[model samples]
Target: MPAVQKSGTVLIRAVEGAQGSSRGLEGEVRYVYYNEPVVTRVEPSSGALEGGTMLSLYGRGLEEGSNLTCRFGTGDAVAGRQETSTMATCVAPPRPVKDVVWLQVSLNGGADFSGSAVEYAYEAGATVDEVRPSAGDSGVDGQTVTVIGRHFGSGQGLSCLFGTRGRVRGMPMTSTAVVCVAPRGGPGAVGVSVSNNGVDEGQTRGGFVYSGDLKGKSAFVYYEGPERGGILVSLNGGADFSGSAVEYAYEAGATVDEVRPSAGDSGVDGQTVTVIGRHFGSGQGLSCLFGTRGRVRGMPMTSTAVVCVAPRGGPGAVGVSVSNNGVEGETASGIVSVRYEYRSGMSAKSVGRSEVRTGLGSGSVYSETL
Candidate 1:
């Protein structure tokens, strides 16, 4: 059956006799067609408030005519081109406010498309007000610097730059707050910038000061860097960092500053210690190494901390090191060091008696001389 031109209930009567026979039996059939257009999705869901965005609507039963109208906020789309029954294209008009607007399309100039699947968000005019802890040491692991500003809008397509070489992006809290790591840098004032969907939005003047530090912080997070991912950073105090933090995949590096349960007994198998630092990936494959005893399994608790079990080892002032599998980059690897003390205990020569206690489990027991 062909599609109906209009919509309404229709009743058809069928007569069983000749046209002149009024006494013949008769039957009736009813039919209805839903001609209202259905909108499934809108392309490029976000655009600048200044408008002039080419938007495409995908759906079914859509026809372009003199009565067809498309509205975005208070502005009406211009030059609507109907491609097919399932697709249409138009240019978005300028909007006065930054918000999520319903995309309305009418086929008969009387139908409303509000509360439909089509929605567009105005995301232009992003600005950066300030960066907390503007000054930082280069190659520091897991230092969280916050960017405060307006029109951040979900921070989905945001990115940032710290200095000539240091850059980081991640941890979006809201439209007003974003937290990122301090990338590796050299001695100088670093520029900062925020970008939304590849367009530069704001810049800060001398926002971050970097010191001359050659050591790289061992970061364990899995990030593609500014090239593929970003967080909003401003320059002048206000635009992009001078260098690319993502270029070297430096977000995986971290710097160790503190450790807990720093001292433990020798040959202990299950001593838990916390490693606090920056850029630790969430539950990433982290490991610990004490002296030359080998790798100890660890768990990344947060972006700034990790917990690991101390492995069996001799007593001495051994250094504690942490590593992760996420720091595979061309520039550097993820690794950091801190000191841990292993207390002296009984030596092997102090053993006196060996008890063959097989019934007390499948292990041997020995007594140590006093």
Candidate 2:
């Protein structure tokens, strides 16, 4: 046996013994060249930090074999089943942080190959820790809201979403912050989320509240008696206090004072009850925070009144919250909301007490036949 260092075609002869002459077996052996991999492009040039993107690498001389290994970033990625001499596939690994890592490939224990020809960008997943002015009114359009979180890059791929309204490509203030104009939604609570590179980041720590305050900078026009209404006072340089109004009037937060029919039997699942609280803005923005069952349909009759059907649950104390046009944090500043208690059973006397049932689900009234 002898060493074959160079690539391309070459002649070779085999000998039987260690020191035997090279004429024992005389058959010409032509060596085939194994060229280095030349990568052409990487599909879906970018991916989320959470990984799981199926990446395709197209090039020539990819050199396919069981010993072939392809990696993305500094971490290991699972090699895909579809591999050939011209193309390869792999599942990207999770990237802990945003980066522009290159792809590396090794075949048959040979030297590793990597370069700019195969670059994959690792974008950190979008996260929303907080949404400033967490609440808004459904009537207000293009209401700017500040989103605070991580990996909010200032790129074309960055955008925000309010529930089902779809992505609103926002202006990125920083890698952890963004400013977006709130889209018009129904008078109810909606989830606030962000996305990067077309990948959804899930719901934020809290949701944006749509209230019925009808309070924005445009709402603050002072019509003086004749022509002296403080000269149309502009408290701030910009007369539009829509953003501030949302934060101050509702999003600043609110508290629940009491829930009518506070004490009920386990069978009170479908009963309509009125919730009394401060900052329960009048509008379709009202939603009931019913423990683990999540937000239930409710209506804000006024700043101090909300009507909702009792949520079915086991006998225990459950928290109740009301928001006026989706106020931020769904509570008033410095106010602690009251809780409702569920009892195991109520005597027939309690059930005999006649209480008018207001229709739940939609804020409408229908005749009760019973």
Clashes of each: 42, 16
lDDT for each residue of candidate 1 in 1-370, tens digit (9 for 90 to 100): 4567776667766566666775534677875444667788887677778776677898887764435567775556445667888888777787787799778776645344534557888766555666664445545455456776666655555666655553455466787766667676655545565545333434443255543442354322212123323332442453434343422222335556667756767877776677777765543446666656666666665656666777877878766666554322112233445777777773343443332322222322333232
Where does the lowest 10-residue lDDT sum fall in candidate 1?
219-228
In candidate 1, position 36 carries an lDDT of 68
lDDT of the candidates, in the order given: 0.58, 0.61
Our model 2 lands, by Cα RMSD against the true structure, at 15.6
TM-scores, in order shown? 0.38, 0.39
Task: Please tell me which predicted candidate would have the highest lDDT against the true structure.
Answer: 2
User: For residue 323, what is the lDDT in candidate 2?
Assistant: 48
Q: Per-residue lDDT for 1-370 in model 2, tens only? A: 3445654556666668566554467676854545566777877677787887777788877764345567765666455543778787777788787789778665533245544357888876676766666656565565668888777766676788877665788898888889888887765555677776545454355456566654442322221112211112123553642222222232434468877767566655576667777766555556677655456666655556677877777778777776443433332331446777777865543322233333332353221212
